[model samples]
Target: MTTNLILTNSLDEIAEFVTLLVIFIIVIGITYFSIRIVGNIQKEKLGRGNIQILETQKVSNTKYIQIVRIGKKCFAIAICKDSISYLCEVDEGDLQFNTDSSISKSSAESFKTIIDKFKKDKPED
Candidate 1:
């Protein structure tokens, strides 16, 4: 009788642990997705602003050269921790833009290939 009671108690504890774990996972998933949705919404809202940073190249840990678009014109600017200095006005014709489809395809293919390689290299348990 004692042995049976211990076994029952152990099973109950395991079931409770599993239930809590599942709930925790669901809450985490909800939070993750909610944050992502909010981030995308905020990006869309902020992206409509007149000032846009088109490109940035790092010169040092705290200094960068950036191409910025304000209104209809684009400018190259030097950005540091303390100040921003205008470098030059950029002609619209000089800019090369990557198409969304090409960028996404390349990124997806690279990521998938990396994961496939990792899985292939890993030994099965």
Candidate 2:
């Protein structure tokens, strides 16, 4: 009878240990999934907070240019009679002037010179 009682007690202890382990695993899984969901939500919110500015104009008689500004970066998208060019991440300080006609070749050349000078002044990455 004493041996039977010991065996029964061992079985009960094992059952209790298994139950606790299952509960611990469920808790850890819940915590991990909750953290992942919250992280994704915050990332989406940050993405939506970004600022976008659009400017469109006719560069010349046959060419059109659209400028987009996101935060401190600027992009110039040009659509000629049959060709398209995308110039991205242009700094505002690199531009000679904030005028629509600044998209012209002469102004673009000046802007390129300014950017080159700025790059030369910065320390190497």
Candidate 3:
């Protein structure tokens, strides 16, 4: 009878520990999801602005061109690492894109082409 009582006490302690662990897990999950939901809600509320980016194209390593729409007019702007400049006004019909995929066919090919070009252009030592 004493052994059975000890076993029953140990089992109750283990069951209480498991229940506490489960409660802690549930609390942590709730806290994580609540924070995530609040952050997403704040981001969505802050994203309602008048200026919208329509298109972007990278010109070089440090230069890019973007078309942005402000209210009713759209303009093209050039962005560099140092400064941003207004390029020109963009009409809807003036947009053009290159359909060829030869520029970035593969990462290895692009690297190899760049190295070859540098070697060809390198001054004699």
Candidate 4:
């Protein structure tokens, strides 16, 4: 009967949809795990080296100032797109390190608060 044919067609379509969804989810999970594994491996390799970037500040689109630690010594360097120049040797005692984990959250909250204040003070059209 046509009724049975319609029911069978819908079931087949549903099964195909479910199969595709499952495949998509599996692919996403595999990609996520692979990325995480690669990242961990890279971090481990980088941490084993004596040269480490302690901090970096962007000066321009193609320029930056970076504080780097080479073994027991720390230096400030200017990095341009084409070259790197040594600025000066930084005294470790004068440098401040942020130990706060909620800095990003606090900064986001402050930005949101500023936006809300701006909106409140705006003139109505």
- Top-TM-score candidate index: 4
Between candidates 1 and 3, which one is better according to lDDT? Answer: 1
| Whole-model lDDT values for every prediction | 0.83, 0.74, 0.79, 0.84
RMSD of each: 5.8, 18.1, 14.8, 9.0
Q: Where in model 1 is the C-alpha error above 4 Å?
A: 96-125
Candidate 1, residues 7-117: lDDT per residue as tens digits?
Answer: 999999999999999999999999999998997897788768998777667799999888888999999999999999999999978988665533323333556677799
Candidate 3 C-alpha error for residue 2, in Å = 15
In candidate 4, position 49 carries an lDDT of 94
lDDT of 2 by residue, 1-125 (tens): 99999999999999999999999999999999999899789667755854443555776998977766667678888889999898666777765545454444343355677879999999997
Better of 1 and 4 by lDDT: 4
Could you estimate the TM-score for every candidate?
A: 0.71, 0.44, 0.47, 0.75
Clash count in backbone of candidate 1: 0
RMSD score of candidate 2 (Å): 18.1
Model 3 steric clash pairs: none
TM-score of 4: 0.75
What tens-digit string does per-residue lDDT give for candidate 4 at 79-116? 99999999999998988877563232333345667779
If ranked by lDDT, best first, what sequence of candidates would result? Answer: 4, 1, 3, 2
